[model samples]
Target: MRQVVISKAGSPDMLRVVDVPLPEPDPGSVRIKSAAIGVNFADLVGRLGLYPDSPKIPYVPGYEVAGTIDAVGSGVDASRLGEPVIALTRFNGYSEALCIPADQAIPRPAKMPVEQAGGFLVSYLTAYASLVVMAGIKPHDRVLIHAAAGGVGLAAVDLCRVYGATIYGTASPAKHDFLRARGVQFPIDYRHQDFEKEVARLSDGRGVQIALDPIGGRSWTKSYRALSPTGRLVINGVTSLTPRARRSLRALLRMALTTPWLRFTPVRLANDNKGVVGVNLGHLWDETALLREWVTQLLAWYDTGRIDIHVDRTFPLAEAAAAHRYLHERRNTGKVVLIP
Candidate 1:
């Protein structure tokens, strides 16, 4: 088997491919012949040695893959042989093959494209946990989403549409038309305009009922200010903490200075009748039942054509370095997949 190994935590050049002996499934596990792998910004953070949940050096760093069952272990059903599936992997998804617990693998809609399935779980599951589990989004509720054209941003846009929410999404001016056609009733160009001001203007100052912000920093306070009374805010990531290209003293100082901006007290939250929740799927590996349920719901949505995901590009496994650069530069409008 072949897999990309993180030679060290630094540049994309540090990621290189190497041959390793094929792995066998442990009891109750299934081996998947990798077809496609999903690349995420979280991968970039891990590669930069910034993610606390990251494994040690010389490790594989992917979270999701989709393929077919090549073998089964004891306690697994023989009928699952050759089954087409998509699964959540701990950190070994950037590989030719992998063994995961049988229950972690879910049936991919036969009609769904393999690349889409490979890139689905991380973004959509996080969105599911945010909207359904945390916010309890309801019909006609005004929702605000930042980075609205990115992978998880697009997923939340579609899911909010299905639930009949009026969406106000923040993105670059270039993405407004693209997002407006999807579900975003209002698209705030973060580079040129103030999202807080625009959102308040659009809502007549009543504010949105639900806000989803994965871009953390000073933006956290802004997103919180855009919330209505009793509204819910879900903070899922902190891309602003690290520079995309390389480490810098200025970037590190900025991160430190912005730290106090995201702080809030439980007393303040309760007094205002507002809610703040954080979701990190990578850190919730032990919450198996919840993960399975979320995956099941997302697959069902895909089967019904209610799940819409755009594949920005696909790179052959050998070109992973180039792919990493693309994501690090934030050039993609949606999912970037790697074909093995």
Candidate 2:
């Protein structure tokens, strides 16, 4: 088998592809012959040593994969062999083949393409956990979504459209048309305009009912301020900390300096009648039941055509470093996947 390893924490060049022995599944686990692999910003953060939860150097980094079950371990159903599925992998998903617990693998919708399925779980599940599970989004409510053309951002847009919310999304002007077609009612050009002001202006000075921000640092503070009196701000990432493809002590120091900006006190929340919540899907690995339930619901939504996964591009597994570079540049408007 071939695997992409983060030989060290640095630039995308640190990602190295090498041949390795195929892994066998443990009891209650199954082996998936990788068809397509999901590339996430977390992988880029891990490659740059910016993610605190990342494993040590020389480890594989990947979050989700879609493939077929070619082997089953003890206690696993032989009937599962040849089943097409999509599974969340803690790591090691960059390999040509991987072993994962059986329950982590969910049956992929027959109509969902292999590349789309590969990119599905992490993006949609993160959106589901934040909007549906946490925010309880209602019809006609105004919502602001940051990075509105990115994977998780588009997923949130689709969900908001289904719930009949008025969406205010922030993206580059180049992507405003794409976002508009995807149901973003108001697309703010973050490159040229202040999203906070735009959200305030577009909502007629009332702000929005919900704000979803993945870019942390001072952006969190701004997103929080863009909310209405009883609005909730849901944060899921800190992409602002990694302004480049490589590690920078200066960026770390800047993040440390801006940490106080995110300090929300109970007294402040009480007085303002607003709320702040954070979500990290990687931290929920132990909660299999909850993840399975969410994945099932997302799959149902896919099956019914209530939502769709947009794949921006596909790269071969060997070009893993290039994939990281592309995503780091933020040129993709949707999911980026790797074919094994």
Candidate 3:
């Protein structure tokens, strides 16, 4: 077997593919012959050493995979062999074959492609947790989604469309048409225009009911201000911290010095009639029952054609570094997967 490891935190070049002994499943676990591995922005953050929760260096960085079960350990059902499934691997998902607890592997929809299944769980789960679970989204609500063309952003757009919410998404000008096609009614060019002003103008100065912000730093302040009274703001990621492929202490210090951290106190919330919350899928691993519930609902939506998973690019496992660079450059409009 082969696995991609982050030898040391630096640039994409730090991702090295090396041969490793094939892993055998322990009791109550199963081995998956990975067909496709999901590439997420968090993986990039892990490689840059910006993610505090990331494991020590010289580790594999992958969260999800879709593949076929070829082996099972003791106490596992032999019938599960040859089953096509999607598994959530907190780490070590970059290998050609890996072992995971059998319960973590969910059966893939019969009609869904393996590539789509590979990228499904994390993005949709994050979006579902933020939009439906946290915000309690309702019909006809005006919503603002930053990075609207990215994986989680697109998943949020699809869910908002299902709930009949009008969407205002921010993206580069090149992805504006793509965002519009994905149900974003107003696509603000974040590079060229002020999204806060655009949201106010587009909503006729009323502002949106919900704002999903993943690009943390000062963007959180703007997203909060773009919200209407009683509106909710969900901060999910801090991509702004790693503006480049390599770690730069100087850049990190500058961001900390320039960005104002808003205090959301009880009085502030009561006076403004607004709410702020955060969602980190990585931290929710222990809430197995909750995750299973959300995954079940999401899979049903996929089966019924209520939502769609868009995969923008697929890279060979050996080109893991290149894959990271692609995501770092913000060139992919949807999920990026790696073939093992």
Candidate 4:
């Protein structure tokens, strides 16, 4: 089998191709013949050693892949063999083949295109879990999504439209037409304008009922401000993870004093209905049933054409470093897929 190994953490150039013996399926696992792999900003963070649980050097780093079931382990059904499937592996996705737990692999819709199936499930499930499961989005709700042209952003826009919500998205101006075409009513150019003011203006001062923010930093405060009195805010990323800002001594002291209390602020029983939730898809697999359920819904959406994900670009596996570089530059408007 061939895989991209991260022998060291730094630039995309550090990712190297290597050959290794094929891995056998462990009990309850399924071996997949790789078709297409999804490249994400989170994977880049993992490769750069910025992720909190960064793996040891010489690790395979990929989160999701779509492929065919080539074999099944002891506890898995042999009937699953040769089935098209997708799985969220957290890591080790950049390879010619892989064996993962059977439950982690969901059968791809027979009618869904292979490339779409491979790149679809992860981002849609993440968006669905955050918007539908955590936030309990309702029709007519005013919503705001940051990075609206990215994979998860487009999913959020599409899903919000399905639920009859009025959607507002923040993206580069060049990407606004794409967002608008996808049903986003207000597409704000975050580069040249303040999204906070734009959201308020677009909503006529009622404020958005929900705000999905994966871009963290000073943006956190603004995300909070964009919400209505009972609005929910979900934090799913910290691209702001890099060195950028430092707090004043007084601010640091206040943060230290409030940290413990702030951590529990999102409790559903709290008197304040306004909410803040954090989502990490990797951690959700602890409840395999939930992951399977979400994957099922995503596949159904793709089958029905309720969600249209524009795959802006794709690269063959050999050019993964170039793919990573493109994602880092933030130039693409949709999913960046690696065809193996």
Candidate 5:
């Protein structure tokens, strides 16, 4: 087996591929042959050591892989062997082979290609948790999604569309037409136009019923302001604070200083009847029943084609460095994947 490891954070070239012994499944676990691996911003964050949850240096970084179960644990049914599935790994999904708990091996939708399925779970689940669970999105409500051309943002747009909510999206102008076709009713060009003003203009100055913000820090306040009275603002990420594929202490400190930390007074939220919601999918890993419920719903939606994964591009596993660089540069408009 081969795995990509980050010895230290400097540039994408730091990601190294090395051969290793294939892992064997433990009791109640299964071993899978990785066919495709999901490349997420979180993976890059971990690789660059920018995230607190990132493993120590010289670590493998990845969370989801779609492949075939080649081995099963003693307590598991052999019937699972040779089954096509998507495995939710804790950290090491970039490896060519993986051994994970049997329960983490989920049935992949037959219609979903391995390349797309590899990156499906995280973005879809994050979107589902934010819009459906936290926002309690309602019909005819207004919604704003930052980075609407990205994975979770696109998923949120589709979910909002299905629920009959009007969608406001922020993206580069190049993605404006694409976003509209994907159900974003109003696509604001965040790079040139003032998204807040545009959102207000589109909403007739009433503001959005819910806003999904992953940019974090200073962006959080703007998203909060974009919300209507009694609206919910969901913060899930801080991509705005991220630097390129490097870990500089000075850059990290600068991010800390420039990023606006949410310090809401109880009186304000109560007085306006407005709410802020924070989501960290990593923190919800232990809530198995909750994760399962949401994932099952997403899978059902995928099987019936109510929603689908759109892979922006695919790269060979050895070019993990290039993949990370592409995502950090924000060149891809949708999910990116790696084939082993």
Candidate 6:
């Protein structure tokens, strides 16, 4: 098998394609032949050595894949062999072959294409969990989504629309039309406008009921302000600015001194009832079955045309570096992929 490995963390250039022995399925594991791999921001963080839970250097960096079950290990049901599935792997997905626990592999929707299925599980699951489960999204709710043209952002839009929430989205001006066409009523150009003010204006002083913010740090305060009373702020990723290697001693001191002060801002939150929460899908391995259940729901929705996976681009397996660069640069307006 051939896989892309970041021999040392630095930039996309560190990704190296190398041949290795195909892994065998251990007990309670399933071997799969990957057809498409989802490229994500987590992969970029891994390359930069900034992801909190990533392994050491010289490791594969992908987290999700869509493929076929080639073999099943002991204690696994024999019927699972030869089944089409999509998997949520912590890493090691940038390859033609994979071995994962059976529970980590979600059965693909009947007749769903490999590419869409490959990219569907992670982002859509996050969107579903954040918008519905975490946010308690309700009918006629007002919502704001940052990075609204990206993978999880778009998925949030689709699922929120299904929940009948009115959406205001932030994206580059070039993606405004795309977002509008996808049910975003107010599309703000984050580069040229203050999204918080826009959300306030669009909601007519009421503010959004729920805000989905994947970009973390101080910029996230704006999303919190965009919410309404009892509105939940669901944050999933820290893509804002960039993930730093290590904080300087002075920077650390400043954070230690000022971190708690931000909460006291008089103008913060929505009507004194808003809340902030985070969703880290990679850290949800303890609830892997729950993720599979969400994947099944997303695939079912896709089958019924209630949602869609916008595959902005697909690169060959050897071009995983380019894929990472494109995602990190925010050039793709939708999910990116690697065809192995």
Q: In model 3, which runs have C-alpha deviations exceeding 4 angstroms?
A: none
Model 3 poorest 10 in a row by lDDT: 254-263
RMSD of 4: 3.9
Cα deviation of 230 in candidate 2 (Å)?
Answer: 1.2
Candidate 6, residue 143: Cα displacement in angstroms equals 0.7
In the range 1-340, model 2's lDDT, one tens digit per residue, is 8999999989999999999988899999999999999999999999998788989887999999999999999999899999999999999999999999999888988899999999999999999999998887898989999999999999999899879999999999999999999999999999899999999888889999899999877788888889999999999998876677888888888777775453689989888899998899999988999999888888878888989899999999999999998998899999999999
Q: Write the per-residue lDDT of candidate 3 for residues 110-173, one digit (tens) a residue.
A: 8999899999989999999999999989999999999999999999999999899999999999
RMSD of each: 1.4, 1.0, 1.0, 3.9, 1.4, 3.1
Cα error, residue 148 of model 4, in Å, equals 0.3
Least well predicted 10-residue stretch by lDDT in candidate 5: 255-264
**Pairs of residues at least 3 apart in sequence or in different chains that clash in candidate 5:** none
Give one digit per residue, the lDDT tens place, for model 1 in 227-289. Answer: 999999999888775557554557667767775443578888888788888889898776889
Q: Candidates 1 and 6: which is better by TM-score?
A: 1
Local distance difference test values of all predictions, in order: 0.87, 0.92, 0.92, 0.82, 0.86, 0.83
| lDDT digits (tens) for residues 1-340 of candidate 5 | 8999887876788899999999999999999999999888888878767778877888898988999999998999999989999866778988999998888788887788999889888888899999999999999999999999998888898788778999999999889888988888899989898888888898889999999999875678788888889999998887854557676676667667756564566878898889988888888866777888998888877777778688999999999999998988888888999999
Worst 10 residues of 6 by lDDT: 240-249
Off by over 4 Å in 6: 241-271
Each candidate: how many clashes? 0, 0, 0, 0, 0, 0
Write candidate 4's Cα lDDT for 59-101 as tens digits: 9888889999999999898999999888887688999999989
Clashing pairs in 2: none
Candidate 3 TM-score over all chains jointly: 0.98
On a 0 to 100 scale, what is the lDDT of residue 113 in model 5?
Answer: 91
Q: Which ten residues in a row have the lowest lDDT in candidate 2?
A: 254-263
Query: With candidate 6 superimposed using the best TM-score fit, by how many Å does residue 259's alpha carbon deviate from the native?
Result: 6.8
With a 3 Å backbone cut-off (N, CA, C), the pairs that clash in candidate 6 are none
